[model samples]
Target: MPPPPARVPDLTALSLLVAIARTGNVGTAAHEVGLSVQAATARLRTVEQQVGAPVVERERRGRRAGRLTSRGVLLVEWAGPVLDAAADLDAVVAALRPARPGEQPIVLAAGPTAAEGLLPAWLVELRDGPGGQIVLLDTDDPAAAVRAGDATLGIVETVEPLEGLHATTVDTDTLVLVVAPDHPWAGGSGVDAAELVATPLVTRRPGAGTRASVEAALTAAAPDVRAPAPLREVAADTAVRAAVRAGEGPAVLPRRAVTGDLAAGNLAEVPVHGADLGREFRAVWKEGSSPQGTARDLLRIATGGRIR
Candidate 1:
């Protein structure tokens, strides 16, 4: 005979753990899940008590998110799929006879920038076809979404290598430094990798693909030096561009992401002297579950038969 199974924490607390994993800050994750700061803190403490371990590690140099502890990461990985499955069951039970009149659901999970900057036009094109239901969820962590069975397809900014999921390169791109026309960096040919890292700059949040590319490049360019940090992290490309235009700080963004501003003369692209920072956009999904029907057709259309 086996002993009784270990008791798990409440679902709400488990959800808070996953939220903390996503945002990396307890307060922010709490607010996202509609919990007050004190309540969130108490819930987290309760979780810690039950698990007999700390869930997160926080650091503040002014204000920014910190990293999750090993236990917290593990719990998030376990909880995401469970929560998603629960939600699915709820929806199915609510409708009892769920059927769309003329639409199939396409759940697309994407990194923040691509979700906002890239997919709008492509989604418009998709809408013209068979008129399926399109659901877009914004998440910086695409890999988690795929693993949790949340998104039918995912678009990520980097192609470094993600395990568990089958990823195909949809596009190749380079990171470009963008600055206001009047800024000092705008007049130069490009800033060297060392100088760029040394300088203060505005950038996307930590989990963003743009940030990932810059960090990777800086590391490769100067293996001995500490990687650069963002002077400020904004959630949207529009905000980052606005702040750069206002002379807040220089930023490195995808060439495709800021093409319009560069063409309009609202921003100038400064090259990174010693770093290529080339990245690839990938469409990812779980193994053995290739996108089928409309999803597959749209994938082909988006990539134009190019997969790699």
Candidate 2:
């Protein structure tokens, strides 16, 4: 590499010298830069040592006064563009900094069910409102993302209350037990919670909101029964639906996710007695922090202006 650059006085010291030249008084320049006169004097001595010449004229008979020598005047003029370029660099760095919530585009983290079924319409409406732009993240744990400040807002489907966050139910969804037309339960009256929990079914991966809701409902309804392992664990709702349509196994999924398949006779919804499969779709944010700017506008639009 090249030789290391030479050390020089920092910007603050140089600016202080320039200020002293402008005001013609050391104490006045010190006050302008929020420094004591004694501290400024020490700093000036350090600057002189670095420059290898006396930059300020010293009075021999009284308190120190700021009177620039010929060298100081020349140094001040040269420092003008250096200080200006430093200021411009500061502005550019600030512009490139990571955006805080509500500062740039609204960052929305959503669970698979909501991302697949709901947010598209709400985002379309937000396009016409004061909300400027949106960056959407499809995640399994949207509430956690919002709580950690990674997302400006979160949409999640759960019956449990979120700790350390504020949540408002914007909509609801139902988990339907679905199977292919050739399955034994396809045309039956329905199965009970015990039987549904005992069967190995196609399911979303462990952290998914859809899987959590179904497991919670099953555990609540049939506390004594042990649930069976999943026939296959898929990553997304569409993949789970595809597995069920291919006769992999029965699966419990968001009704909205399989509406088209159910209507087309490709998948059949089998009822589950003695258990509630309903869940609330909620908008969540950090505790004590209210949505603002684009997030607020999108929330208002999502809730039909009822949440503002």
Candidate 3:
């Protein structure tokens, strides 16, 4: 293959050529791309020089506007995909750019528990410090959001390892089995893992980090017993809390989520014997791409000034 062209018309010049082809008016095309007619004329001349061809035929005295030469028409057609690809690249870069420090509107994705319980405080701390606007996405699958470039950073509570992402433990939380005040387990000795695994419990819907962590803990504690399905699967932590408060069933949830209720005597925490329900609150980003700028500042706040 021959070497690439050492010089080519830039995107703006190529866009002008395409616009001229569509509008069939040099001045209108120039205006569309934010250029004065005279400056556009000069740019067209430069493009022609770079391409070694005349790309436009100037408007004659009687004609209303100028039109592209045959070569110009071909150049516009060739630049179509190039311009499209450049636009696509620009969008991707914009999506990723917010992760860089100082980018506005830092996009953050967080699991339901963190969004409801933790992020408010962290955001308040961020506002008090190196502050910037933040777009908070409350999601069940925060890792997916970060991986897809929809979020600059993600906070998740999970026991499962995240693949292809850089994760740092920002905090630790425990999943506790909680029941309404009147439930049998509320007053009795804590239930064992086998019994806990056998009971149907209200829970967050599948794919939620809390639900996954609870399931993993149960399965680990009772390898031979398949954990029963949820009594009711709700979309949000608040819904799950409501369901449990209404005496729907027991739910294993992040302690932080039910702390207020527990304190208010609306919910009772039940111990799960021989089961480890601890999980880490982690901040995750795309592997090889650490958080920067406002995102870094926010992460620092989340981790209490420790970023690792």
Candidate 4:
């Protein structure tokens, strides 16, 4: 006997569900899906009923636990081929339609740290290569840009495992515990992970990948060491460094960001015992899509062809 076909979720609903899986917040996912939060909530409820599952979850160890159900994940997987086909169809229709007289340049989306610390230098070298232009779009969610066809290439810093796309590891960084030179921990050889988490270190906001990594490690190594919040939650890397330097508290940040300060005797590093919160810089593009011309050139330059 032939098996029953999988349920066909509404196209718009399925797309919204995928956005929820990507962003992990109904309101933010709603923004990405182009609906108001109220509308998104109602829509999600309808979809949940249609699919017979609860996809978005709740807090886990003081983190946003919103994630996809197995069925919701399946919907994301099923929606991918459809979205790709739609993109292809759009390309064909665009080809048949009258020319718009202006072409959309290739777009690049980069996380804040990578954009500030690394990408600019690499882009400077490209000035000698091509007359072709690339536009920069703002977002921390580089993988989302690739998924939504907003960018031909994207660079993201994330603690979450990379999935559901074609991506490459272009660079790596280690998170170090940085403190003001005069601080008590400065002379210490190392601080245990358990002790560090209990200290309310200066940190990025909850959703930032680096902070997420730190929380995950703390929850695993010593769940009892959890703090009510960060020592301080600042938006910018500069602000985080400034807060740490002001002797407010110690911080865990990428070594690249504070290596100069450490060298200048402004800050000191205390080893983090039992945890190495390493991070990767990824260049991502949509799965099953190929880059041509300048996009290909940029990928070669960015990754040296060693993409993961």
Please list the residue runs of candidate 3 whose C-alpha ends up more than 4 Å from where it truly belongs after superposition.
1-104, 160-163
Ranking of predictions according to lDDT: 2, 3, 1, 4
Q: Residue by residue across 164-282, what tens digits does model 1's lDDT show?
A: 88888776777888999998888787888888878778988877877877888877886676655678989877888888887888988878878999999989888787877888778
TM-scores of the candidates in the order shown = 0.62, 0.63, 0.62, 0.62
Off by over 4 Å in 4: 1-103, 159-161, 305-308
Residue-level lDDT of model 3, residues 1-308, one tens digit each, is: 24677767989999999989988888899999999988888889899898797888855563324688888888999999999877645533343334446546878888766766677667656765786667777678899999999989998776578998999888888889999999999978899999999999998878777788888888889989877667898887888888989899899888888889999999999888999998888899999986788899988898789888
Cα error, residue 45 of model 3, in Å, equals: 72
Candidate that beats the other on TM-score, 1 or 3, i.e. the better one: 1
Q: How does candidate 4 fare on TM-score? A: 0.62
Name the runs in model 1 displaced over 4 angstroms.
1-104, 227-229, 305-308
User: Ten-residue segment with the worst summed lDDT in candidate 2?
Assistant: 88-97
TM-score of 1: 0.62
Please state the error at residue 195 of candidate 4 in Å: 1.1
> Alpha carbon lDDT of residue 119, candidate 1?
66
Angstrom error of the Cα, residue 82, model 1: value is 43
